[model samples]
Target: MAVHKLLDDLYEHSYSLIAIHSPLKDYRLAYFLNHQLSLKLKRTKDDFSYIENTSFSTFHYNDDTTDTAWHLITNISKNVVNETRDTDLFGIKSTTVLHYLVPEYKKVDYFLKIDNGDFFYQLNAVLKIINEMTHVVTAYTVDPNQLKSKNNLIFLSNA
Candidate 1:
């Protein structure tokens, strides 16, 4: 009898995730990143929606010079729900629910994903420039492999 083993490394993650903490809105942060990193990131036509009624704003930029793709995605999505009950004076209650792309890092405002195998060497410099932005509270790298929702980062098809 011959034995065969399955290969688990078929889908290798060749990307780097950088968690950004900032108060700036998605577009504003993209603007700051564009100015600081010399990247021309623009909003995509369709927002990334992994679940019903929840969508995350996404910005994309492809650096032809370096043959790399960059994506700036909001980590949080807010949805409002209206509920009616006789106990309330107005009989209506409004609630806001939050959704996360990577639920493990709920406090992270945004994620910067770089799709290039060789970009890790320059990751530190990129983080430094992002951190220096006045509007950005702080920016640091996050290992995608360690994320429980790592598969959510696969947005190339939607992009």
Candidate 2:
């Protein structure tokens, strides 16, 4: 399946915190994200006014300028450690399957830091979906407490 179509499906189901990867694609990881976001923007022309307005954004640490990409990616994982906002959905796309197995960053952080409440169930549902997809491509199950001690300093939390 096309990567964009996969993301579109997730978006439709109200899963804002998502991660996507495609082993079949040979292009840069950013290419798929930019393509999909632009398409969504075009399709949602009447309601969405900005790239962020589409309700999802792509976050990457490795723009290929430095060695901090992994650090940045981990920091993002740390900060969201249980994000509660339903409005914040993001995707991490990469052609390499190894990128998918970077030691439980996003999934673990989000799961561990979330506070118990109404959104917990919903978030669990989304994580399950994400895990299903991740496992298919990377063979690693998303574990909530997988990276409790892991730290990356580049993308430090503002809070």
Candidate 3:
């Protein structure tokens, strides 16, 4: 892809990312982002509207769906800040993030929650493993249920 074309393509479809829908893709976002969100990325007709979500940290991705949502959400937060010059584009207020983890998280700061049902309960082992990997200040998970018209800062925590 030409430099301009690639930048143009990234602009339109940049904000929305194709996350690791399953444990299989978390460690390799390029494959899934390229394969999964291909159509969305095509909407950009040019201009620096979007940049690829490449927030590489010491925290490398691993094939663990346990807290994959949390890691991805944190990545989104850092990505927005780094990519958008740290501007709060949507003018968000309080953000509430909901994620499903089998064992649930402890002493978490920022907006976050673990579902009180089987989704998390079933994946208990995975949740424990993922939780062991992180110890940071982050707002993770956006509840699809709260996605009501614009009041979705909390909902966007997942995005």
Candidate 4:
């Protein structure tokens, strides 16, 4: 499917559902923090922390709450510069429900509606990061343990 189509499909879904499918593993989370977002992941036995330059923060995602990270990444992908009225389902300025899945960042309306070309450009930049993170996460695990969770993937943001 085209990236735009893929993104629209993703945006309509629940982040909680996506993360349970293996997108929120320790390795993948670490990769996203350290590489994709240019943040540092530090484990201290009891918690996971992410740091970017001087902005240091910590996050936790057991089987219950980990899917949130995927939600943000997924929803952010919906930012299309030239989306028609049909694709603008979330309103002109909306904070993705994905961010609500994750607790680190304050919920704010932050996605910018852009054109197809700009949308693809932004998606391409992040896709590289997501792809790399995916590779790192996929290489080590044959069966992802998180997928066993039976929680419903629901969008809990400004939906």
Worst 10 residues of 4 by lDDT: 108-117
Q: Report the poorest 10 consecutive residues by lDDT, candidate 3.
A: 39-48
Which of the predicted structures, 2 or 4, would earn the higher lDDT when compared with the native? 4
Candidate 3 RMSD computed on C-alpha atoms after optimal superposition onto the true structure? 17.1
Query: What is the Cα-based TM-score of model 2?
Result: 0.24
The digit string of per-residue lDDT tens for model 1 on 22-135 reads 999999999999999999999999999999999999999999889889999999999999999999889999999999999999999999999998998999999999999999
Best by lDDT: 1
Instruction: Pick the TM-score winner.
Output: 1
Candidate 3: how many backbone clashes?
3
Please identify which of the two predictions, 1 or 3, would achieve the higher TM-score against the true structure: 1
The runs of at least 3 residues in candidate 1 whose Cα sits more than 4 Å from the true structure, single-residue gaps closed, are: 1-9
Q: Model 2: residues >4 Å from true position, as ranges? A: 1-119, 131-149, 153-159
Candidate 2, residues 1-159, lDDT tens digits: the string is 655434322321111123343342222323433353221111111221122212221233222332221111211211122334555475433231111223345332211122222334555554444345422242222333333432221112221
- Candidate 4: tens digits of C-alpha lDDT, residues 21-112: 23354445555545655544344233211212111122322222222232222211122233335456664543322222223222311111
- Enumerate residue pairs that collide in model 1: none
**Best to worst by lDDT, what's the order?**
1, 4, 3, 2
Candidate 1 Cα lDDT to native: 0.92
Q: Over the stretch 1-159, how does candidate 3's per-residue lDDT look in tens digits?
A: 655434322322112221122333233433333243221111112212123543222112222343332223222212223233345765544533333221122232222223223344434443333334333222234333333321222232322
Model 4, residue 76: what's the lDDT?
Answer: 18
